[model samples]
Target: MAANPWFSWTYVVENADTLWEHTVQHAVLTVEAVAIATVIAVPLGILVSRIRWLAGIVIGTAAVLYTVPSLALFAILAPLLGIGRTPVLIGLVAYALLVILRNTVAGLDAVDPAVLDAARGLGYGPGRVLVHVSLPNALPSVVAGLRLATVSTVAMVTVGVVVGYGGLGQLMFQGFRNNFYRAEIMAATLACVLLAVVLDVAIWAGGRALTPWRERRRA
Candidate 1:
C-alpha cells in the first residue's frame, strides 16, 4: 500500500532523463573548453617560458581573468557571443588560462638544467632536447594543469546555464521554482560532486603513475 507517497522517491526518477541529458551536455561543454584552453595556454606558456619578460605579463593577465566574476563575464559575453554554448565556452576557457599557463611555466622551469646541458653536449639539437627530454619531464606539470583546467571548466559550465544553455544548474533552479524539493535536484548535485571527485582522483592517479621517480624517492 506504500507503493506511492508524496516523497516516495519516484519524483527523482521522473526527472532522470532530463537530468542525464543535461549532465551529458555539460560534460561536452567542459571537455571542449579544456581542449581549447590547453592548446592556447600551452603554446603561449612555452613561449613565455623561454622569454622571461613575457612570462609575468602573460600569466598576470590570466590571473586577472580568473578574478573576474563568472556571472559578470557571462553577461559581457552574452551580447557579443549571444546566448548559447559559444559565450559560455568562451568564459570557461578564459577562466582556465591561469591554471594552464601557470602549470606549463612551472613544468618548463622545473626541467633539469644539467640534463639539458648533457643533451647539448651529446650533439642533441634544441628541437631534439625539447622533444625527448624537456617535454617528457614537464609532462607531469602539464597534466596537472590540464586536470585543473578540466575541473574548473566543469564547475563553470553549470554557471553558464544562466545564459540559457541549460545544465545541472537549470535543474536545480527548476526544482526551486516548482517548490517540490524534487530528488532530481539532489541527484544533480550528487552527479556534479561525483564528476569533480572522479576528475580529482583520476588526475592524482595519473600524475603518480607518470612520476615514478617521485614514488621511489618517497619509498
Candidate 2:
C-alpha cells in the first residue's frame, strides 16, 4: 500500500505545539518592524512634505533602500548584526519606510486648503491645526500605508530563514529538507498568509473606526 504523499493532518496535529510558537514569533517580528518604521517614517514624511526639495531626496532614498533585494540586504546586514532577529528586524523596517512615508506625505498634502484656512482664521495655531486638522484628515492614507507595510513585512519575514531566524520560514525549510513534507510546508505557508490578511483587515477596521465621519457620510 502506498502512503499519503501530500498534506497530512497527522503531521500537523503532532507538530501543533512548535507551529504555534513559530507563528507567534513571526507575528511579533512583523508587528515590531512595522511599528518602528511608522514611528520614524510618519514624522519624517510630514517634515519632507513641508520642505519641498527634501521630499524628493527623502522618498528617493527610501525607494532605493527598498529596491535592494531582500536576500542581498539580509546578507549585507548579517555580518554587522550577527545571525539573529536584529538583522531581520532592521531589514524589514528599511523595506517598510518607503511605503509608509509616501502614504503619509500624500495624506498630509491632500488635506483641503480651505480647512486649514478656516482653522487659522478661527485662531488655531500652526501646531494646533496640524494636530487637529491635518492629522485627522490624513488618517486614511496613513492607515493604508500601514496596511501595506504590515503585509509586506509578513512576507519578508519568511526570508529571514536564511539567517536561521525566520519563524514560519524555518518550518517550511525543514519541510523541504525532510523530502518535501507537503503538510508542513502548506501549514506554514497558510499561517503566514493568514497573518498578513488579519493584519491588513485589522488596520482597515482601525482606520474606519478612527474616521467615523467618512462612514457617516456614506450612509
Candidate 3:
C-alpha cells in the first residue's frame, strides 16, 4: 500500500496513538505550570504594586525571563532537573510570569481611585480595600493574564520533548526521526495548534463567567 501524503487523514490516523499520548502529556504539564505561575505571580504582583519602585524591577526581571528561548532554557535546566516534566514545568512557569505579572499590574492600576477612597472612608483597612475593592476590579485583567498564560504554556510544551517529557512534540520528533516524514509531522503540529486554541477559548469563557462586571460593561 502506498503511503499517503502528510495532509491525508489516513496518514495521520496511523500515528493517532502517539499523537494522543503527546496531547495528554502536554495538557497535563501545561495545567500544572499555569497553576503554579498563578499562585506565585498573583501574590508577587500584589506586593509589587505597593512598592512603586520595585514593581519595575520585578516586572523587568520577569520580562527578561520571557525573552529566553524555551529550548535553550530547557537545555540549561535539563541537567539540574534531569530530563523530565520538572524542567518543562519550570520553564513554563517562568514564561507565564511575564503575562501574568503585567496583567496583574495593569488590572490593579485600573481600579477607580474614588472607589478606593470610598472604601477607606467606610473605615475599610488596607486588607479590606484590597480584597473587596481591588481584586474584583482587577479580575478581568487577571483573567486576561490567565488566557495568555494558558496559550503560551500549551505552545511551549513542545520543547519538553528535548527532556524526554513525551508531549505532542515527541510524536512530531519521533515521526521525523523514523522517516515517517510528512504525515506524522503535520498531524502532530495540527494537534498542538488545536489544543492551544481550545485552551484559549475555554479560559476566555471562564474569564467571562468569573468577571460578569466586564461583561456588563460590554453590554
Alpha-carbon shift of residue 43 in model 3 (angstroms) = 0.6
Candidate 3: C-alpha RMSD to true structure equals: 1.9
lDDT of 2 by residue, 1-219 (tens): 125345677777999999899999999999999999999999998898789999989999999999999999999999999999999999999999999999999999999999999999999998999899999999999999999999999999999998879999999999899887788888999889999999999999999989999989899
Q: What is the alpha-carbon lDDT of model 2 when measured against the actual structure?
A: 0.93
What stretches of model 2 exceed 4 Å from their correct place?
Answer: 1-4
Order of candidates by lDDT, top first?
A: 2, 3, 1
Angstrom error of the Cα, residue 152, model 3: value is 1.5
Poorest 10 consecutive residues of model 1 by lDDT? 1-10
| lDDT pick, better of 1 and 3 | 3
What's the TM-score of each model vs. the native? Answer: 0.87, 0.97, 0.92
Q: 3-99, model 3: which lDDT tens digit per residue?
A: 7476768765776776777788888888889989999899988988898888889998999999999889999999887988888889999999889
lDDT of 1 at 157: 80
35-146 in candidate 1: lDDT tens per residue?
8988999899889988899988999899999999999999999999899888998898899988988998899999999999999999999889988888778988999888
Higher-TM-score candidate of 1 and 3: 3
TM-score of 2: 0.97
Off by over 4 Å in 1: 1-9, 180-182, 204-219
